[model samples]
Target: MAVSPAAAADTDRAGTGDQRPRSRRSGRRRTALAFWAFTGPFLAGLAVFTVVPVAWSAYLSFFDATNTVTPLSEDFVGFGNYTRMLQDQAFLDSLVTFSVFAAFIVPLTFACSLGLALLLDRVRFARAFFRSVFFLPFACSYVVASLVWKMSIFNGVRYGLANAVLDLFGVDDVAWLFNPDPPWYWLVIVSLRLWIQCGFYMILFIAALQQIPAHLYEAAYVDGAKPGRQTFWHITLPQLRATSVAVVMLILIAAYQAFDEFVNLIGNQAYARPPLVYLYYTALGTQQDLGRGSAGALILALIIAIVTLLQGRLLGFGNKEGR
Candidate 1:
């Protein structure tokens, strides 16, 4: 049972197989190192910017941390801030404002985007150009758009585009964003949101509509189904349910987080302050009530979670029943 020294030497040299390149494992190890090298900074930033801030805010929610969020300045309050924020009339009004905004924007954006997608899907020439035209607004900053809407379009003067149109109709100059008695500002806000966002969601619907199997439509057509209404309701609409849910959810979240437009269009008004705007004045404004703001932030996060979950459940987003 004698073994050659040469084989043992070869086994030691190869490690696993004599024919394999010696650098393969090292190359794989280097590849893994490179992957982590590329991704490490992003992960670190997520921890520092996203995770730490969120965790710290949640921690500060239970404390009296006004004027300073540092650990040294915190005084234990144990849900007092949450209770107070829940009772605050301004905060509750902000929630109601968020609800109204969401109700107006979500359905409108969904419908407009889906309609645009359907129309674009039918276009045979210059489709990409048309899509880019519609989607170009998505690239514009919200602040810039809000300012343009406030100052140029609905600036409440005869020189403004809206007022000029009114001038055509022999109508008097009307203050759009300035008048809260009739709340005409809602028109400006909602229209601006729809113009900027509908294109992006239209692209989503376009992608989803393209994902619908042509054979399904063909099969429906073969079964004597009518083309427009019947085919759309039975085939196109049902196929788009997932994308519709996703679009609605994104719109819902965006609507709740509305701040820049509301601030620019309406200013620091009491009428239409959404929760983030209200919470901003609480935490970072002159009040500096970081504890209440943090509590409100957590509460808003919970509301977003509950709302998203409910929408998903109602829409059968995760359901396997039909799909």
Candidate 2:
């Protein structure tokens, strides 16, 4: 028997409904495949270069994976490597030095960078030129910069630029690199760091400063807010708080990871080495003990993680909308 027109229409509607879901599923599958196709190589590279090494390092930390011709032939020592750190006086001293270094450099960089950003924000002339001039140092290699500081600017001789300036004040040339009595080395290290890194953070702050709404400043001005410190405190700082948090965190991480310059300047000297430099010397330095090196790295990672978490908690780092 022939189906009625209404029944035929219902049948066609049922077919169309079934086909819609199937088509949707097929489209979703294609999109997923395309995503994987594009991202697969990057994910593979990340796994090989980053994720695998990190995991292997953690594994090695628990073992006596040192002094063996073959890494795989190493025996397990459990937490022996970790406990070694307690007895390692030089490593302990390095941690102290790094903490002192971070304490000084982080705040100084933040303040100087923010100050530069503020100054540049107000400059109607030569703004870009000044920004480039400041930031150009950041592009220079840290090793080269440190060497310049050691060889040219802060050279222990009387002809060094810093020593010449001191001479103008009748002070004798100071051994900035080798003098550990009053820790004159810190001046070289800290000044070099400020000159190289402050510009990068300044650029970040500048970007954040530019992002602040102009209308808010205009509104503040109409309400008798001056363009000086008043406007800066009320309008600029609060707006830059998030960027400031990020800059501070970056500075902390970078400070903790310091090695190249320290090694290049301090060499094999036992004085004023940071944790990373210490770790390098421990693992590969005359002894070649990979186990202890790996262990120190993991411990440093833990310390950094703890400190970062504490900072995020204290500063409410990730909170965007007010609670």
Candidate 3:
């Protein structure tokens, strides 16, 4: 039997209401899919370019591979490369050099940066100008800084600014770079690193210092706390805990990777070189041993990872206690 006109209109309206929800659901799904489709290429490129290459390098570290026309043709040597690295005296020496460098640089950088940040935090006039001046060294290329230090500052003779000033004081010219003595060369390298990095960490500390509530300092003052005592026991040190942890880790990592300055300033002809420079000289200059180079790189990577993990754990523990 044919439906009445009123009944047919009710059925059409019900059907339209049900279909509307389905259409809206489909539109939402399509929009989400389109968003992913747009982002998929970038994600894929990062995995391909960065992640895959690092994985491949780890794989290559186990093999006796050279930079050849065909890398795949290289022989697999298991832990042979690693074993050789363990016995290498030059590798041992480099490890010691890098360790000493880290020991000196990390603490010195933190102390200097913290001091500068505190001083700058109190400054009222031309704060921006002072900050820019301090951070200017970080803006210069490492190679450029190295060259400038080599030629102008540490030039051994009276031609160098340092020696000229010393000469005026009746002091002799110093062998800043070429010295194979106990601490002079190492001191110079450490000083250069401190100068370059202190500015960057100072900026970071300034930012962290800014995040701290001014009311806290005011409260301390209201409580009859002196500036030096309050900063030591309450304000400066506690607020800087997290920033200190980060700066320590960064300085440690950079100290281990000290290469550009050492290479440019002292060159391969130096009596002492850092681990990275030593590895480069071994792989390309003297030994032509890609396997050993890969092994050294892997070892350095492991050391960095272990140190970072330990620092993170310690920092996490401290944060929990602070909370």
Which one is best on lDDT? 1
**Using alpha carbons, what is the TM-score of model 2?**
0.88
Q: List the pairs of residues colliding in candidate 1.
A: none
Estimate, for each residue in 1-323, the C-alpha lDDT of model 3 and write its tens digit.
14443454455555555567677555555555655577668768988997786676667767776663124644788898898888988787877877777778888899999889989998999999999999988888788878878899887888898899989999988988887774577766777887888999999999999988888878888998887865566877887777777788777777777899889888874366777997797667756667668778788789888978887897763463245
Q: Rank by TM-score, descending? A: 2, 1, 3
Which pairs of residues collide in model 2?
A: none
Write the residue-wise lDDT of candidate 2 on 138-175 in tens digits: 99988999889989998999999999999999998899
Which of 1 and 3 is the better model by TM-score? 1
Best by TM-score: 2
| Model 2 worst lDDT window (10 residues) | 1-10
Candidate 3 accuracy as lDDT: 0.78
TM-scores vs. true structure, each candidate: 0.86, 0.88, 0.82
Worst 10 residues of 1 by lDDT: 1-10
Q: Compared to the true structure, candidate 1 yields what TM-score?
A: 0.86
TM-score between candidate 3 and the true structure: 0.82
Provide the lDDT at 36 for model 3. Answer: 56
Clashing pairs in 3: none
| Candidate 3 wrong stretches, greater than 4 Å | 1-49, 66-74, 269-271, 317-321
| 165-235 per-residue lDDT for model 1 (tens digits) | 99999999998987787899899999999999999999999998998899998998889998899999988
Cα shift from native, residue 168, model 3 (Å): 1.7
lDDT of each: 0.86, 0.84, 0.78
